[model samples]
Target: MRMDEQFILRVPPSVAERINRLLSENASSSEDKSLDLEFSEDGRTGTFVIGNDRFPASVLDLPCVVESYKTYDDSALVKTADVGQMILVRESGEASPDVVEYRHGLTPPLRDARKRRFRREPDLNPELVQRDAGDENARNANKKAPPAAAAKPEVPDTGGNAGEPDGSDSDDSDDSM
Candidate 1:
């Protein structure tokens, strides 16, 4: 719950270290602990204890978290900024008493996005959902399968020149001999 404690953001160890370094470098003389990380879910936020106490907490506004995020991005954890991967930045609630106090022992679902597949239910109308059966056949039919290429005649090897015209019967052969 302090500015110095902001370095405790749950991140990869390597990233965390880098973040800590950055935070220390950017540290101000006076510490501020007004910001915190708060997590929440409509009906699915709970804690599991191995052998420690759990308590609700708020989100932290920390430089380490931001720096850690940068490190992860630089490391290409999600792949890329566009196309192959994406990073989802979201705010659960405004900073204040209205913030959801998630349990400490609980593993909050960070960057929880809906499943990509089946994002929207199929249309109710059968006709609208109907797929063209003959479409594939028609497409195949329309595409004229290219004609098989004519086989090239193999040139006879006379030992003179493979592609040169055969003039064995000419005076040239007699001259060579």
Candidate 2:
């Protein structure tokens, strides 16, 4: 599709309802009402955010333009189009109306990075894996025996006014009052 041309995206009824609700809520709350739609790096999944609420959504058929944008950079805001009204696809005999729109968002670089960083991968680091295995074996070997109690060090006694409750020197002979 041309850059200026608008495209349509099909979302579930729940998503459409959420969009409508967000639109209404934002319209009453602020003059700059906007529906922020962000998609995954793969463009397969997305989410709609308005104010503090977030609604997760999936794209049935992501357009090439969005995919192109995602490929261009780590962070991409593909396009901004006027969100059209929900319409029922009578030809397809679909029970729910689809949300028509041309705008979409991409997962931010930081978000994607964080996701990758936190994702579990046992074989990611062989050294770490080996260390963990060793630790497990050590724990299992020592399971039968209780750990020895550590002895507390005793403080040496110093005969002086160090333990005075006033915590001040008795030689307070100040001549310069």
Candidate 3:
């Protein structure tokens, strides 16, 4: 990581002294240790390197009280007992191989929306129930219908009684057959 991108951590003086003592002891050990420790110029931040794995200074300073370590397909998740935060480190060559931090594990804080529960009704023209008497179609209809035809008497049905069914029950039966 670039020097500008590195995070400058703030630690207590006693904790810093203890970390410095531990680093010196680890450095003078005859056995080849897997972890390589490095401190920042201000003596506040420390880096712990193990093989290809790298952790933040704040994360490395925590005591060895790990809650869990879950290995995924392309990443590893670490949960520490000191802080209730889940740290996710992705494998190399991945598109976004970065250390991600989560408060709980999965969910994040709620965000604001540009719009919410918005409704819109389409524009519509009113129904034309009444037509103007001076319209061309109205004038043409009045001209097409003569006054004599409009004054003609109404025709009635030939049933035996008004508003009743016909009494005839004639069925289709051929006498020649």
Candidate 4:
């Protein structure tokens, strides 16, 4: 955070505002949000707290040693964030980098991997076909004979009294042999 040295940074106004709000809770006197940040020669950084605790931030810059043309993807931070207004320091690093909201969201666009999907054949199972054939033969053999009618389900009789007439214990007291 010195005057000359460059550094990486990620302090957009929105983020700074949030930090300012967090630091303003117990300001003894006023609700002020002014800040003065400074860094030491030994890389020790400090900030002057004014009305609140929030202060501006900037990151060290990263060196672009290995460079290449990204024919596939755009610059990593083209439109991911509203970072155009964020502070930048001489320390080499991108400021207010936009991180992906969800790691699995929006998979990088893919090429036509399977252009011949229409030409693909339907999946077949020889074992299933054999089982179907067996079922068909069984049905044909059973076609010669008719199935018997099913018996009706028995219903329990409930009389007005507690002891009801059960088939196992008949109430035919009048038919004494």
Leading candidate by lDDT? 2
Tens digits of per-residue lDDT, candidate 3, 4-39, equal 222223333543454466566764562323555576
Best of the two (3, 4) by TM-score? 4
Clashing pairs in 2: none
- The predicted structure with the larger TM-score, 1 or 2, is 2
lDDT of each: 0.37, 0.50, 0.40, 0.42
Model number with the top TM-score: 2
Give the 10-residue window scoring lowest on summed lDDT in candidate 4.
99-108
Off by over 4 Å in 4: 1-9, 12-15, 18-30, 48-50, 54-59, 65-177
Q: After superposing candidate 1, which stretches have Cα over 4 Å from the reference?
A: 1-106, 115-129, 160-177
In angstroms, the error of model 1 at 9 is 26
- For candidate 2, write residues 131-177 as lDDT tens digits: 99999999899787767888989988686767766444556844557
> Candidate 4 on 1-177: residue-level lDDT in tens?
644322224444654564467576654443564555665563333333434454433332222211222233664533222211222322223333342121121123312222322244667799998999999999898786667889989978555566865344556655667
Give the higher-TM-score candidate: 2 or 3. 2
Full-model lDDT, candidate 4? 0.42
RMSD of 4: 21.9
Ranking by lDDT: 2, 4, 3, 1
Per-residue error (Å), model 1, residue 141: 2.4
Q: What's the true lDDT of residue 90 in model 3?
A: 24
Please report, as a residue range, the 10-residue window in candidate 1 with the lowest summed lDDT: 79-88
lDDT score, residue 138, model 4? 92
Q: Compute each candidate's TM-score over C-alphas.
A: 0.23, 0.26, 0.18, 0.21
